[model samples]
Target chain A: MSSISLEVKDLAINLSGNQVIKDMNFKIKKNTLTTFLGPSGSGKTTVLRAIAGLNQKIAGKILLDDTEIQNLAANQRNIGMIFQSYALFPNLSVFENVAYGLRVRKEPKATIKEKVDAILKTVNLQDKEQSYPENLSGGQKQRVAIARAMVLEPKILLLDEPLSALDAKIRIELRNQIREYQQRLGITMLFVTHDQAEAMAISDEIIVMDNGKVQQQGSPLEIYTHPQNIFIAKFIGNHNILDAAQLRSLGVELAENDKSNFIIRPELFQISITGDSSDYMAVSGKVKNISILGDRFEYRFITENGLELKVEFLNQQQAFMIETAITFYVKKDNIERVGI
Target chain B: MEKHIDRIIAKIVITLISIYLAAPIVATIMYSFAKSWVNTILPDGWTFEWYLQLITNSDFLSALARSIILGFVTTIIAMCCFLPVVFYANVYDESIKAKLRFITVLPFTIPGIVLVTGLVRVYANLPVPQMLVLLLAISLLSLPVTYQALDNAFIAHDFRAMFEQALILGDSPIKAFVKVVIPNIRVGMFIAMLLTFTNAFGEYVLTNIILGGNYETLKIYMYRLMQSNGQASSVLTTVYFFFLAIISIIMIAIMKWQGSKKAEEVEDTKKL
Candidate 1:
């Protein structure tokens, strides 16, 4: 197994007498991109800030390469951070902004120029070295911010929703660029975002948090395929979840009620003619609505017990009419059993 | 049609009010330049004699120099003393900020005469120079204005961006303040300097009471000249007014430049 690049153990953060992060623990391996994924106000950003040493009142131990650094100031931590706002120096030219770290370390002017030039080229900002931050586009500003952080070559790079402020197209473009840059540099990175798709797109591993606690932590496929609890199942992707009692009444034997949850991804449900199929769990429902989503048709249905379920088909040609009574089959293996 | 009529009436009213506000300064300048005109709506003749006389007066020259020096000194001292504390309060502890804000404004809200009177009584026993006492008084009075200007600047800044970038770049707080915060809020700093300079230049009561006629600022020169009541006094007033007008023009030019720069930035961002 790869050695841990960064580790947080029983970390807690309180702000103005309110607990924001509670006993959060995670370990990120070297040369990997780890993401903290959660909704707004879920303390994901707070946890990232704690790791960066931006949150002073944080409790518990944070180890960077096996060295305890929880008490270090943000500058002393040597952790590069890209804020949601990009945080580029408005007055400085792109070159100066990127060269700021080297200058602060008292590097010789020649070396500063060489490193800054190289890093600017790395972020595709070499042509715009003379541009002030205020004159740059959102995407360009984000790149500058990235370059500014990367030039320091710190232990870990912390990105606090860096692409959240960009337009959808720009966000996608920047996200891919960031992932490519991270891969090229082979640096450990902790990316924080509320968007699951963005997190899943780049993360080697993702920690889904909710209400100040870690709900689940795993690789993208692991999280999508097998969430550890209901929150994770709901948070990672769209899911049609039902209580064990409800699943049991549908001829699905749930192993336990108090500790397990029945979760089926929206796309996992199969629409077909009713038949005796040992390898699949079947349910009968009336289609309530149909949405054409280009490549797929999303069907919303109401089960006999009033549970709402969403099922998707490959095309509108496969969609059943509204109010049509049908049985949806979920392959048994695809029906994930999550323990809370 | 009715709305248009109302708009015309409103414009006229605004124009008249603007004229009323500006008339006194215009009249002052006219009287100062008039060769011998008196009790007339317009000057009988225009001459540069008053302006010339002001150039030759040694006492007037000394007072003008003192005013400029005091203005520069007071603004420098006020900014150095207040900005760090204000920036700290703004960033770290907001609760303490409220109390500090109150303290900074205490000198402004209290009646100037009363405050100067108290200062005189208290400082009479101290073995400080009269000029030092005068500088202290002017700085104290100007602190509230300077602090407010800087505080507003801090509010207008993207502080999260400032700190985050600084951290990522491994910059200490002081370096960040010098490089990032100061440049971003240059307009605000300029306005603060102008305000402090104007306050110290025009301040009369504090200087009068503090120096007790030993030291003279531009305002004191004008006051002394006003006692004689003639072209000399008018010339002194004109000199003071001209200096203030020059400062005001410079401030406006700086403000306009900043605005245009901001607009250019916006346009550039849009293009991207």
Candidate 2:
């Protein structure tokens, strides 16, 4: 199958009188799942609506497979979107909902039947082909919704918080199915989610946003290990954000004007018994709290200089549980500096 | 003991309210079938002679026919025009909704006498038929109920999302509305139509004031019979009561049909 790429350039959206989405640009690579990761009201869903041409007052060029489609009507764009509500026509049975687009396009009856049947099977909703949306469980309704969209064979599928409404078990289970389907079909998908774990699990690349603008866009690991700003660091993990002055007092290498903060992961801090103190900056602290997290142990500690710290250790050692006066070591190489 | 008393008091209040509301209609129904009901609290005699006398009158038949025709046509006009208008106002032009709310309440605030007087003074010189004017007037009076029904139709479900989803699935706005929106809001539209029909059917003041002798509706026909043929008029009233009862049954049937159709299952094989 041929590949399709979607690129948005300098997109700005103004709703009523206020600007909701500022100048935004992003490219969804071919056959890759890229998620717009942000909290609610961060303009992520606004971007999805704009791309679908539902928000007409957008100023930008949206190019799909090298053709500008900003002027196209929503129906004319041929982009399939899975709404958060699933939005399955309540009056329509599962079969009719899947056959709706095909019927609108005036496809042959037998072909519509075959395609709808196959798609329903693909989503594991064949048993529910006769049921209405209200009669089905939340997971079944979502699968029918997916089957309805997938049967259309659109160029790109836009999922706007598709799994956010489901329970934890169904969400993870269905999202993994969607990811597998994305891989099998090699379909270009731009999934919008507020969950960092969801983005990390499903996306080939994740675009993190706070306000309207993109905070950081990269692989989940690249984003997690090397957050460009304090927002991304604070958002992605439970890392301790220490300012330049605090780090300087701890005697890490830095210039005089290094006023920016630094991120230290919990797992990166080590006990001085295993590592040489000459190579790593060593500090002793009072253990404030300790909690076991299955495979890892988390400790809240306050140093002599009054800097609070959270450090996680592998469950292989219970010795740290009793050590309140133990020294912790942090390598200069492991300290990640924030650019902003 | 106190809680039991509270429950008993609540039940008594509810039963009293129900009887109070039902008493007038019960009295009216009893009066319509009576031979001489004024001498005592109980009706003097129950007879079908008034009904037989009512059906034999050509004027009564024509008035009944006229009222039904007008009510049906007015309901069709209201639904055909107002449903789309409400849908558009809700989905596209929200500003028009404020105007619709004002117009819906206009019929209720202005007395029917005042409205008829204004309309007569305005349309007195026009060459149009008085029947059409009355039909249009009755329909206008039913607008508030129709608009509210349509509003509820859109609001009670995920209508906006369904429309947008259909649009994304390659349906034009019109096609999406007719095929997707119309079917889903079918129950609401039916209710609005029924309300409009009942309003037009039972309307008296406006019909009498504006188009009384020229295009006599059932209400005007009954009013005339009250003086000339009181028993026949009572018979007409009984028939009208039955007509309304039949309509109510039909509305309930429509509601039941919608409910049953929604819960039905299609037997598709090739289960996964």
Candidate 3:
């Protein structure tokens, strides 16, 4: 059997008169949670919708297990989708909502009940079988939506910002539950979210998108540490990006032909007063601003050469005041070269 | 003191408007039971003789029955034509709704008399049944009310998501619509039907001019009696008014019930 569960090749979509997605390509390994992370209007949701057959693509080949499904209707594709809105049928009880697909497929009443009951149990919503959607909390409604899609045991599932409408605590709780279910069921899942933190927390692989194009596709840590371009570097994490001129101003000597931008994460900068500059590229700067970021203190530091950079340090009992002189160093191995 | 004076003036204005609107209906109700109402501020005597006569008359009963049939048929036809169009506009192609704006203004742009005149000119020499033509015409005229009420149903919920979810759950488009969409929008459909039925039942010019006396609807019978028997006509008019009042009451009751249900749903969510 093929290890890849789903793939898209040379996809292009034009909505109305504008090209929304252009030549998009990617593949999902079986049973892995891959997230399309981007800012809003980056076409992540549009790409997810196109894969689910809810959107029309002007040119594309969407394959499931290496078989083309781009021409299939949405229902025939057997692709489960959980929308941002839970989209539970208001008139149907929880059990009925989950059993709707089974009932539509003409399954026996006993089998439908068994499947719905089992799926509801999996989602920890067994007690909510008789409850209507209106009576459930947002978290509970989303559980029912997931159960409704999972009852059919689809080969793959698409979740389009399903937790975006939820509260912070519920979003954290539900995303963990989603990851657990994906692993337990071994279902290939494509998650679309504009939240970088949520995507990093839940995804096995992250495909960062910007302006309807894929910027980087890799493991969450890989994408974070080795962003393919300046956009990804800035978008994925709060990396301090320095162009060649800025690098030169920071007293960093570059090769004659080396003209690449350098990216160093805010958290990777080590602050010290006694570190020898020989072992690391060190810059002396004064703290310009301090921000309390819960567990970390983010200090905006301005070097003597007028290069502004952000450096994050773990919160400690002692605090540094604004305008306090500080020296921060980045190891040579930690700085990454990226494209514009 | 100025605020107090403003409140008093507002109350007076509301009271005067109420009286202005209710005076005619109040007088008609009194006149329906009056022994003789003219040349006096109040009736000299009260009786149910007009009511009894109207109830006993076969023509009045048949006319009522015909008007009811007309209302029902026109409602069905109008729903059949407009429900799918409205659902498509709301769910899939919202651009179609922009083109449908002209239907809301149809009655104003083409009055019933003018519409009937055109219909007679076109279909008079044809072999089609005039009653069917009248039913279609009444349905077309009631489209504005039906369309607006149906459109209001699409609000308050993410129907597109609900529908697409159903489709992904192994339902064909039609099955998804019938299974998911219709149940959610049934209340709105009922409201649209009620409005359309009321418009058709109370339709005067189209029915009278198109079918003449062949189809003597309630309004036509009232018009006939209006020319000869003043007391009986008043009684018929009062009955018609009560019929409309009952429909209005039902509509209001449904709206109140729906509002309470929504409040209960919100309360339920809060409790969780």
Candidate 4:
């Protein structure tokens, strides 16, 4: 299997006289899945389309295995794309839809049949071989879409929020199925989605973007734990953002003087009934609210200075009263400084 | 009980409307078959003599052939010219729909005699034959029918996405259009052809006012019979209705066969 590396350097795009993507850059190593996670109009879908060569008038380089493809047509680029609608040919049967790419390439009949059958089985949709798109459920249509694109075995696959149209239950079910296929085939894949939890769940590397620019790109854990900026910190996880002046006044050292924003993860702060001396700084606050999630509990606290902080607790053995005061401690190392 | 009452009322209304619409055609058909029914409750004698006159008339036969030729020619030209135009407008400029609607309804507002008169002057200097000019005029008259059919097809199917999907699948744009887009919209195209052809076939005013006796069509031949044989004109109309019914049945059969296939596919998917 030949794994192709993808690189987009200083890429920019303007649609109808408006700058939609501005100086975006990213690279994907071979045989890995990277997701562009952002809100709508954040230029994530446009970047994916640019890489797929669907959008013209894009500036800068898009390289697949050292070959510049920005000027190439979509067909010449050899990139597979699954649209959000699944865009299955409604007239064709599942077998025929999967066989479309090979048939168009003028592969022999026997080869097309063999490849299509194998892919249908991989998607676990072999029983729907003779079924048209209208005859299949939403989940089945999704599988057929993946099978159609992957059967071509293009250099890279780009998916534009393929699961956004599905319901919650099928979305999660098909999500794992896609990850399994991508890993098993070792194909280079770039998936775009606006759902943060979905990005965290399936992405090997998540590229968080906002305002038509890349905010940060790292492993899911790294993005959760070490968000590089204030936008990313707030976007990725529920973190208490406080002024560096408050931390410094509380006897914590400053990383830089000009940047005043610091972040602490909600789960990193430990809350207790007693305000005891510890290695970390301790602060007391009154419990404002407590919310019970499926497997965890979140507590909202308001300090003496009227600063609110959220702390999460997995073990809910100690029930703190709503108006009672509790002390929450955080290590100095858990404090992450971020730029505005 | 309320639902049952509503169903009965709807059935009664539909039956009443059907009879109201069918009454004129029934009277005309009975008149053509009557031998002599001047003031009686029904025809005193029924004869096939008028029908025989219609079949034996050479002018009428030639006129029927001419009308069929024009129908096929006009419908074919309309479809060949407008499919791509409709597809382009749909994909590139959606605002073209308003323009299309305007042009489609324009022919209806202008009297056919007026429209044909304007046409003769415009082509007065052209070297084209009057017959060719007539065909072109009729095609233009039915342009909206063909264009609307294709426009509706494009609206129903997202041809842009299908085209893009085909290109990504390694087919050229032309190939994708020919193989995928055309087949998907084939039903709409067939409907367009049939509608335009039917309009061109029954057209009387354009053919009568411009081409006149020089190029007599089926409708023109029927008009000529009104002077000499009023009963023959009724016979001609009855025979024309028969053929129309046959053609309608065949077209409906084709549409239903294809339509049911699609419907079954949808229901099957639902069952899954």
Candidate 5:
């Protein structure tokens, strides 16, 4: 068996007359969760739908287990999808909705019941077996949708913003539950979402996309700490992008042959009241604004040259009044150089 | 104070509208039961003899049966033709819906007289059965109601997602539609079928113009009675009005049941 459960090569899709997904290529490993993270019109869902054989691909190949299956109808593809809307059949009870696939395949009555009951238990929804979808809460309905898709035992499961419709607390709980179930069942999952934090929370690998293209794909830590371009730097976290002139004004000199933008994370700057550090590049600034972010303090520092930069520090119950003069330092090795 | 006045005004308006709408039916009912009502504020006597006579008439029973058969056949044909088309338009190709908007205005643009004239010109001499042509024409005429009701059914759910999910679960398109899509929209479909059946049941112009007296439907029987006997005609009209009232009651009851079921679901969700 191939290590890759699903692969898309040079996939392109057009809706009406405009191209929605362009030359998209990605591979999902077996029993691992990968996320397609991007903004709304970034073609993330388009690529995911193409992989499930739901959307027609104008040009490309979709391989499942190293065998081409792009031409197969969506039903024949043996893939499952959970939509953001939960898409539960309002007429069917929870058990019926979960058993829909098994019933379609003509599974025996006893087996369908056994499988549905087991899967419903896995999602902690055994008590909701007789409840219709409309009577359930959003979180409960989503759980039913998950159970319905998972009961089919698909080769790969595609989740399109499954938690986007959920509340904050429920979203966190459901995402953790989904990741747990994916691991327990050993099913390959392709999750699509515009929320970066959700993708970072549960994905084994995150493919960041924008404007119908894959901007970057990597482990969450790698993508977060070492963004390859300015877009990724700006999108992934609160990173300050400074040009050569801005860096010079901040008392940090670029390399002799280098004039690219530097991506500096907020927490990378070490702040102090006294200018005692000469080994690292340093600048003096005042705390223009301070936002108490529960666990950390985000300080907007303005340097002598009037260059504004964001600096963050772990909250230690210390007091720093507004307009307090402070010095911040960063080593040359800590900055990431990104192209224009 | 303002709210009380508003309530009073609303009640008066509703009462006036009710009287205006119900006056004709009330007069017809009174006429059906009157023994000698001419030039009198009230009937000199009331009797059930007209109703008994109409009920005993063999032609009246056959006319009622024919109208029912027409209703059932037209409803079946309308569902067969428009259900799949409306589902396709709503789920897959929304552009088809834009093309189908013309069906809604077809009756206004081409009156039944004009359509029957065209149908007679084309199929009057053809080997095709006139009854079949009439049935087909009636079904076509009822398409607007069928299409609109069926289309409304799809608005409440993400039917595409539900259908695609079912397909991914191993159902062919037809099987998925029958198993998953149909149940979700059954209420709406039922309401549509009822409306179509009601429309076809009460049809007069196309039936009279196309099939004529050969297919003596209830409406045709009523029209004939109107010229010959006033008491008998009033009785037939009253019977027709009751039939319509029963159908209207059924439709309203179904709508109310559906609404309550939805309200219960909402209440359940809120409790959750």
Candidate 6:
């Protein structure tokens, strides 16, 4: 069998006179966890649905393992989908729910039992065989949903914000568990989430989407450290954006009328003595506010040009005093040039 | 203190209304068992003689059987017919679904008498049997009600859940309906069945006009018997009341079970 890879080319979807997804394109390698990250209404879920053949009337081709699946119905596409709600069959026992796909294909009862048992074990839900879905915990329900979809041995597994409905602690725990299971099975996985942190934490490749288009797509660290646009910069993590003109006035290097936005991460700003710049891009500012956050103190400051900046300092021993004049240094390499 | 007094007065008024609503059924039962039902504020004697009389009457028995059988059959047919239409409408598109919903409930908007008159006109031309015509009339009368119940049930369900379950499992729409949709909305289904059955059983005007004194359903039998003063009529009324009460109790029990099951499911999910 050919390796299961997914490619979407110039996909466009219009629903009720509104173009929700426009010319969106991406590719997922076989046996890798790829995530589509975007704010709500940014068409992340729509893209996933389109690939799964849940959304018709799309103007593009979706290829799975090099076969065009755009015309296939949702069931015929052989793509597994775990809904944001977990979508476990509320009426069925855990085993039956997991074995649902196999049962539908009219597999032998013994084979269904064996496959369900193995999949349940994979999801660490072996003990929940006779338990109904409503009796499963949020994380357990998510696991059952994953098991249910994966048992079909689908070409690709699509998870639409699976951890969003979960509590915080469970979200973290289940995220790791899902990643582990996806890796172990070598299944091509496409995860959708509005949460950038969750996306960065689990995905092998992350596609940042905004306004029905791909903002950026790269490895987690690459996208986080080198955002291609202001939207991706602000969306992936907290970043203080400054105009290129403002950075040039502060004696930072600039090409003639580059006119691009400069993004500096909050964590990259370090407080140092004005005279001890040490080959770093330094700017003088007055600390306007300081707040304690466990092991670090986050300081908000105003520069001479009336621009606001935030810096996170690792609190060593003393509390940071408010209204203190501090010189903060941002490494030149850390300042990423974003969209014009 | 003045506001509290107003609240108390409102409570008293509501309680009085509830009691007033229950008074008719209590009076009906009392009159059905009363040995001397006339010229008295209350029964002078209570006995099961009327009930016994109703059981032995062949016409009354046949009417009762016909009513029950027609009620159940209509309910089943309504469920089978309405579920697919509702499910398909809900799954496909919203605007079209809304139009379909309006059409399904069209029978309810038209007054029952007006609708039944139209049905009579249509039935008059057909060469169908009296029993089938009666069944069809009763079924049409209860159609809107059953449709509404099942439609509401379908609306309340997680469509994504149902669709995803079916899609992932590779199950056909029919299997999904049987296994997932039906079990999830068992309460709504039960209520629809009971309401449809009760409505069919008690319907008089359509049965009367359609049967035209030829076929006597339970309601027609009761109406004819009530016209002629006899203890046998009172007994039949008592039997009918008892049967209605039993059905009502069963429906209530089913609803309660459904509610409890849902609560238990919620609690179990929380525990997990």
Q: What CA root-mean-square deviation does each model show from the true structure?
A: 3.2, 4.1, 2.4, 3.7, 2.9, 3.8
> Against the true structure, what is each candidate's TM-score?
0.90, 0.88, 0.94, 0.88, 0.92, 0.88
Model 1 lDDT per residue over A1-340, tens place: 4499998999999998999888888899999999999999999888887888777798899999999999888889989998888777777899998888889899999999999999988888889999887778887888898888888888899999988877799788989988998999998999999999999999999989999998888899999988898888888878878777877877776666354578888888876534558888888889999899899988898888777888887884656899999888888778777876
Q: Write the per-residue lDDT of candidate 4 for residues A13-78, one digit (tens) a residue.
A: 998899989999889878788999988889998898889877878999999988899998888888
Top-scoring candidate (TM-score):
3
Indicate the residue-level lDDT of A156 in model 6.
92
Per-residue CA lDDT of model 3 for B1-272, tens digit only, reads 99999999999999999999999999889999999987999999999999999999999999999999999999999999999999988988898888897767777788789999999899989998999899999999998889999999989788899999988888898999899999999999999999999999999999999998999999999999999998899899899999999999999999999999989988887898
lDDT of 3 at A337: 89
Report the number of clashing residue pairs per model.
Answer: 0, 0, 0, 1, 0, 3
lDDT of 2 by residue, B154-180 (tens): 875677889999999999989998888
Error of 5 at A53 (Å): 1.1
- Pairs that collide, model 2: none
Question: DockQ of candidates 1 onward, in order?
Answer: 0.69, 0.50, 0.87, 0.56, 0.78, 0.59
Q: Is candidate 1 or candidate 6 better by TM-score?
A: 1
Model 6 lDDT per residue over B1-272, tens place = 99999999999999999999878767777777788867878879998877777778788889988778778887877777766777777766545776776776776788768876787677778887767767766776787777777777766557656765586567666666787777877777877888889988888887787776776779888888988955666666767778888988997888688679779877766665
Docking class of 3: high
What TM-scores does chain A show, candidate by candidate in order?
A: 0.93, 0.94, 0.97, 0.94, 0.95, 0.94
What lDDT is reached at residue B71 by model 2?
Answer: 87
Of candidate 3 chain A, the 10-residue stretch with the lowest lDDT total is: A271-280
Docking class of 1: medium
For candidate 3, the share of real interface contacts preserved is: 0.95
Question: Which pairs clash (backbone N, Cα, C closer than 3 Å) in model 6?
Answer: A101-B169, A137-B272, B50-B235
Candidate 5 local lDDT, residue B77: 92
Model 5 steric clash pairs = none
> On DockQ, who's better, 1 or 2?
1
Better of 3 and 5 by DockQ: 3
Task: Flag regions of model 6 displaced more than 4 Å.
Answer: A1-4, A253-256, A273-279, A317-319, B1-53, B85-110, B118-148, B151-157, B266-272
Off by over 4 Å in 4: A1-4, A245-257, A272-279, A315-321, B1-20, B92-103, B108-114, B126-137, B155-157, B243-270
Model 4 superposed RMSD (Cα):
3.7
True contacts kept of 1: 0.80
